[model samples]
Structures are given as structure tokens and as C-alpha cells.
Target chain A: MPDAGITAFADWIATTSLSHLIAQKLWAIPAIQSVHIMSLAIVFSSALVVDFRMLGLMSTGQPLSAIARRFLPGVWIALIFATISGLLLLIAEPVRSLPTWEFQGKMLSLLCVIILTLSFQKLIAARAPAWDAMPGVPAGAKLAALVSIVLWILIIFGGRWIAYHAG
Target chain B: MSITEFLQALESTAFATAVREGAILFPFAESLHVVALAFVIGTVVFVDLRLLGLASRNQPVTRLTNDLLPWTWGAFVLAAITGLSLFSSTPERYFTNTFFRWKFFFMFLAGVNMLVFHFVTQKNVKEWDNDPVPPTPARVAGALSILFWACVIVFGRWVGFTL
Candidate 1:
């Protein structure tokens, strides 16, 4: 089936409608764009802080939990922006974006990131003693963090290129 | 094959077919690109601002950049690859696009700007040079760096509008 066919496959029916509805709402488009940028700031800044820790360049001495606690707010904040921005963008042109290849690739990678981040939260970071022990970051934990970081990076680039793709 | 042919080769392949078909796979790729770009650019701006004395004044410039360099490089490398991938799908269209033309062109200048910063100004940091306020030359370079990146983003944003 073609891309249009896939959207009509019943499973994608809800997603299709949601995208169309959002795209049609004129006021929502710019609002989401603003939110998306704000969220991006939080996400990127917070992640870089952790990345620095992973490489052992900076030590706050407060522990990984503390750092994570502080930055997590940022992560969530940025995520909200991303979601809102994405939704609004989708709202503007659901059928067009719904069928595009870049849009699908972005979604798949996002799923992989979400799963990894949630699954590893406890194992990589839960077992520490405050400033004394810090988070007992495992190799796997660091690896997960690293992967999450890299994937997010790719997602943004791809997202920007979507418009170019259509042209 | 010509360079253009090598790049456009993807347009003629199954991937392109799937993309044209608007499969789930294509949208996912596009998302990844946007996310990566924000991370990379955000990181670069963060580091660049620190260099120019915007924030992170207590930290060493050399350390700031060196520490974050890998992430920056990672972002750049991935952005370039994905960009090439994107270009592959529409060689002629992009080749003729004014914004596309400026994007690659400015992207090149930004890369050069980065290189010049490291080689030229980075050398002075180790010599007990502390400038809560950057010196004249450093300030100039810093100003230039900031402007260049802003253009990179501005031009990048407009690429969509114009193209």
C-alpha cells in the first residue's frame, strides 16, 4: 500500500485525525513552535551537563542523583515544549507530514530513546548514597545515557530537514 | 558517476520509494534530524557563549570547549550525514534551492570559523590568561563567532521559508 494507504490502515486512523485537527488550528502552530524551542534549551543544556560528568571533566561533588534531580526538571520541561511544538506542526499539515518518510523515521528513533531512558533510570542511577556515594553509574547506564544523547541529536537534524525533503 | 549522481542515487532507490510512499520510516528519520540539530546547536551556542564571556565565567575556556567538543563534533558529524542523506533524496531540487545553497555555504563558513577560533584564540588561554571581560581581539572574535552562528540558525530557519 502507498503512504496514503498506510494512514488509512485503521491503526493509523486516530493519529491521522489528530494530526489534521492540530494542523487546522492556526493559533496553535506558532505557540507550539515557541514551546518547542524552550524545551529544546532545557533538554540540551541538561544533557550536556550530564555528558560532562560522564567524561569526568566536572565534579559537582553533590552526586549523580542531585545532578539528575536538578536536570530532570529541565528534561521534562524541554520534552513538553518538544511535544507541543511537534503536535502543532503536525496539526498544520497532517496528511502531508503523515505520509512523509522523514516524519516516520523521527517517530521510530523517538520510541527507541524513550524506552531506553525509562528502563535504565533505576539500574544506572538509583543505587547511590547522596554526596558521599553519588550515583553508582554502571557502564551500561552510561552507555544508555550516551545513546539517548546521540539519538536526540539526530532527531533534531532530521526534523529540520523535513521541510526541505518535501520540496 | 558524477558527485551529483552519487548523491542522488538514493532518490532512485527503495528508500526513496518508501519515502515517497510516505511510510512510517521516513517521518522517524526527519524527527531524529531535528532533535539532533537542537542538541548540537544548543551545545555549540552554550560553549560559544562561555567563550565570549556570557556565562560560565568561572570555568576555563579550554576546558569548556574541550569537554563539550565531542558532543559538538558528534552533532556536526551526524548533521552532515543526515544532511547529505536529505540532499540525496532531492539533488536537483535542493541544488537549485537558494536557501539550500546558503545553508551549505554558511555551514562551511561556520566550520571554518570554529577552526580559526581554536587555532588562533585557544592558544592564549593556557598562559594564565583570565579575562572576566574578554580582551579586544578575543572580544572581536567572540562577537564574530556569535554573529556567524546566529546567521547559521537564521539562515537555517529561512531555508524552509524560502525553499
Candidate 2:
């Protein structure tokens, strides 16, 4: 049950001019990696704050909606930068990335996180005000926060492992 | 003793020796370093964004800083501890790495930037505590803080790859 289309896309990415430029330029990889890590900090930190709020950890004085409103936009922006940087890195070394189990895990984790993040955003939009008014977080919100924490840790670990175990 | 001797001696200490030799412990420390990084920088970004009048506009700057500083400091302590452990494992390498020097330089600048903001621009914080856009000096400090921290993260990562 291999996906021919996905494999073909990966092949095309490897042969692209953009990939060649990235691989050949010494500064390009480090510069892109620097931006990638910075964007990672921004997105991950923003999401961590929201998750903490959900778990009743910090910023308890502020409305969850207010905190989310303030941080989620930055999260979205940073996520975009991170994705582009990540794509460039992957394309530049498609042979290394495409065949690695850790890379596959990282991609799968990222996809799951994207889904979870969108749903969490919707949940925050609809219920954050109520949750803020309540004395304690509802069980469901806390559960979602826990799931987010686990998923994010897995994603981070997968990212690190990919480097150590790259093909 | 020479600096080299000092670093080599430090590297051979029980704690440093244990961290370097322990399979699980070194990796665990690295994970802590990353987690602590998120906590420390994330909190600083929140405060800096507020100072720049880019986010949390309705909230008073002082209150926002007060709320976030405690967490920032707590995370920083953890980061410092783990960072020191990592350094001790290979003190001479970090000492000689140019990226490491640049990382330290930016970290020092970030500290000075914070101190200047607190002692100077923050003297009349209440006057524009809720201003959608803070005064020029506060905004400058915020902007500088962001720049310094960004450099710190960049060079810090560079040290990893270069070493």
C-alpha cells in the first residue's frame, strides 16, 4: 500500500532547482535552520501558553480567550515560517529525509498536531469565555491540553531523532 | 592554573564526569535544556510583545510583566542549570567555539537591555501603562530585547552544529 503520488512528489522535490541551491550553499542550510529553530520556539511557546491556560497552570487571572487571542496569531505566523523552513530543509536532503523512519514519524506527528491545533482553536473560540468564567477548567479542556502536551513532545522528540538517525 | 587546566579539571569533576558518562542522563539534560528554552523565551516574548504594544493592548504593561517574570525566572534557572551541565561536559570546546562566544555576547547584551529598560524607561511606567503604543524608549527596549534574544538563539544553535 505505498503511495506512488507521494513518492513521485518527493522525487520531484529532490530534483528541483530550489533543492539544489539549498544543498550547495553553505550559509543557506544554517541560516534556514536558525530561522527554523526560532520559529519553532515561537510556535511551540505560544501553543504551550495556551495549553497551560487550559490546564489551569498559569495566567489564571486573565481570560483564556484573551490569552489565546493574544498568542494564537503569533503561533499561526510562526507556524507558517517554520513549515516553509522545514520544507526547504527536507527538499534539500530528500534522500536523507524521505527514507528515514524518524522523518516519517516527525511528519505524521506534525500532521496530527496541525489537526489538533485547528480543532483546539475552534474549541477556544467557542468555549473559552465560559471556561474563563468558571472557577476550574472543565475536564474536557484539561484532557485536550494533556493530549496537546503529549503530541507536542512526540513531535519535538521526532524532530530531534530524525537528525540523529537520518538516512 | 592555566584556563585550559581549569577547564580540564572542571570536566573531570564528579558531576561533569557523571553527566558525560551517563547514557540517559546527558540526553535527559538536553531535553530539559529545550523545554526550559521554550519556557524562558516564550515568557520573554509575551512580555516583549506587550512592551512593543503589539499584543495584550488592554492589559497594563506592569501587570503583564509582573505576571510573566516569575515564570521566566523559574524557567531560566532550569535552563542555566542544564546549560552549565552541558558546558561542563566539554568546557574547552565551548570555550573555543566562535559561535559560543557570540552566544555569550548576545546574552550579555540582552541582560543589559533589560536592566536599562527597568532603570530608565520604566521609571514612569504607569503613565503609559495602558497606552496602545508605549513611549519611544520602552518600545526601543522591547525591540532590542527581541533582537538580542533572536541572535542568542541563532548563535546558540550554530554552536551545536559547528561543535
Candidate 3:
């Protein structure tokens, strides 16, 4: 259960005119959600490309920095879109979204994945030349790639579970 | 039996019932479907952008496609499986939904677009693989693929609302 402070905040948001407007509009939530899903596709796929390169599963001949340079910008841009649409969703259903464990867990996982992705990018920037010259990518970079993949999958699952869980 | 009877029977099956009524089964399947779909669209978007010369301009088209095709197909298979499972859970509802019909129609178009790209546009891939921008046919295929997939996602989401 959410604490009193959180519950009160959710209640207050639910009663707001913006929330009321969103709730009254039948197409609003689904439209926002479609944008959210599209943005997620961009972010997740871009991350997958970078991670795959780090794992040496694909594009091994290409420099890691090159792959990162190509895909990371898309990831960041899509993240901005996802965040905006996701916030609209939250504003539309504060009571339904803000007080739920699934929602909270999804948010937490999202934060961790974002941090992990940033660190992964920094690691590539600092070590790409050395790693590219090696016969194979370093184990540490591969581990980070693996962690990033798992965290993304978990975050996706968490997003779905939020709908299923009682609010 | 008639189509309606068949659909009713399918929906009444134990597996379908379990998926529809069970606490976790439906959501689990949906989550998998979404994840798999994200990868499918994601990989496809990367290739499409390459075709349009919007990104990865230095990478050869054939090499990029060769590298990403396996992941795209792999994720596509997963999405299909999960999608079928979700459809099975409530056949009649989806069958009656206009958005659901549109979703499948767009998916079919996407498939046709891929076939045309592979069998027709890509016949001369070697000629333009190294080019920053692909040939017109390849670019058209890429644009159509992105549009079709976007329709698929939009209609797919609308199905839930309309149902």
C-alpha cells in the first residue's frame, strides 16, 4: 500500500481538471500509449544494436564507437518522446498509476536502465579503440551489455504488469 | 462447423479460458508480445533509416541487413507466437474488432513489402550497397515498411480500446 502522503498526492492529482479532461477523452489514453510504445521501440532497438556490437554478435568489424555514435542519439531522442507520452499517461490516471506497486517498480527499473545505459556509453567512449583492436570485445563490456539487455527486458515486463496489478 | 461456432469453441477451450481468466497468464503473454514487437520494430526501423540515408550512412546496406536480419526474424517469430496466444484468449472479441482487422491487414502489407524488397529491389544490392542513399526501389520499400509497421502498432493499441 502507498503511504498516506503518496495517496493524498494521487488523490489530489486525480481531481485536477487536466486529469478530468484526459479521463473524459476516450482516445487520449490509447493515443498517448501508442506514442509511448513507438518511442520505446526506438530506444530499445537502438540499445540492442549497441549491446549486440559490444557482445560481438554483430558488426564486429565496425568500431564500437561508430556503432554507439550511430545508435545512441536515436536512443536519447526516443527517450525524450517516451518520457513525455508516459507523463501524459500518468497525468491522465494518477490514482490508477501513482499508487501501484507495479507502477513504482517499473519507474525504479526505468531509472536503473537509464543509468546503466549512460555508464555503458561512457565505457564505450573511453575504451572503444582498445576493445575494437582486440580479437574480441572485453568480458567486462560484454557483461555490461548483458546487464543492460536484462534490465530493459525487466522494464518492459514491469510496464505491462502495471496494467494488470490492482491500482 | 460454422466460423462462429469454431471461434466459440476455441474460446471455450481450457487453455483459452485459463489465459482469459487466470491472474497472470494474459498479462505475461501481453508483456512478451510487446517486448518481442519492440525488437521487431526496432530492428526494422534501424534498417529503414539506413535505407533512407537517415542514419548509419557509412555502413554498407547489405552488411547491416545481414547483421540485423537474424535478430529481426527471431523477434518476429516471438511476436507472432505471443500474438497468436493473446488472440486465442479471446478470439471473438478480436475477430469483431475493426482495429484488430486493420492490424492484421497492415502486418500482411508489411510482409508483402519485405518480399518485394528481397525478391525485386535487392536483386541489384551490390550496385548501391555502398551508396549513402539506396536506390529508389529500396527507399520506397523502406518507407512502406515503416508506414505499415506504424499502422500495425497504432491499430494494435486501438483494438484494446475498441474491444
Q: Using TM-score, give the best candidate's number.
A: 3
What value does DockQ give for candidate 1?
Answer: 0.17
Evaluated on chain B only, what is the TM-score of candidate 3? 0.96
Off by over 4 Å in 1: A1-42, A51-167, B1-10, B13-22, B128-130, B158-163
Ranking 1 against 2 by TM-score, winner: 2
Predictions: Cα RMSD each: 7.4, 2.6, 1.7
Per-model lDDT: 0.61, 0.82, 0.88
Report residue A144 deviation for candidate 1 (angstroms).
Answer: 9.1
The reply for model 2, stretches above 4 Å from the true place, is A1-12, B14-28
**Candidate 2 Cα deviation (angstroms), residue B117:** 1.4
- All candidates: DockQ: 0.17, 0.48, 0.86
Better of 1 and 3 by DockQ: 3
Order the candidate numbers by lDDT, best to worst.
Answer: 3, 2, 1
Across residues A1-167, which tens digit of lDDT does each residue of candidate 2 receive?
Answer: 25565567778888999899999987787788778877887888888778887788777888888878877887789989989999899989776666667777877878887788788788878986588775446898788788887877776666766655622
Give the residue spans of candidate 3 off by over 4 A.
none
lDDT of 3 at B140: 92
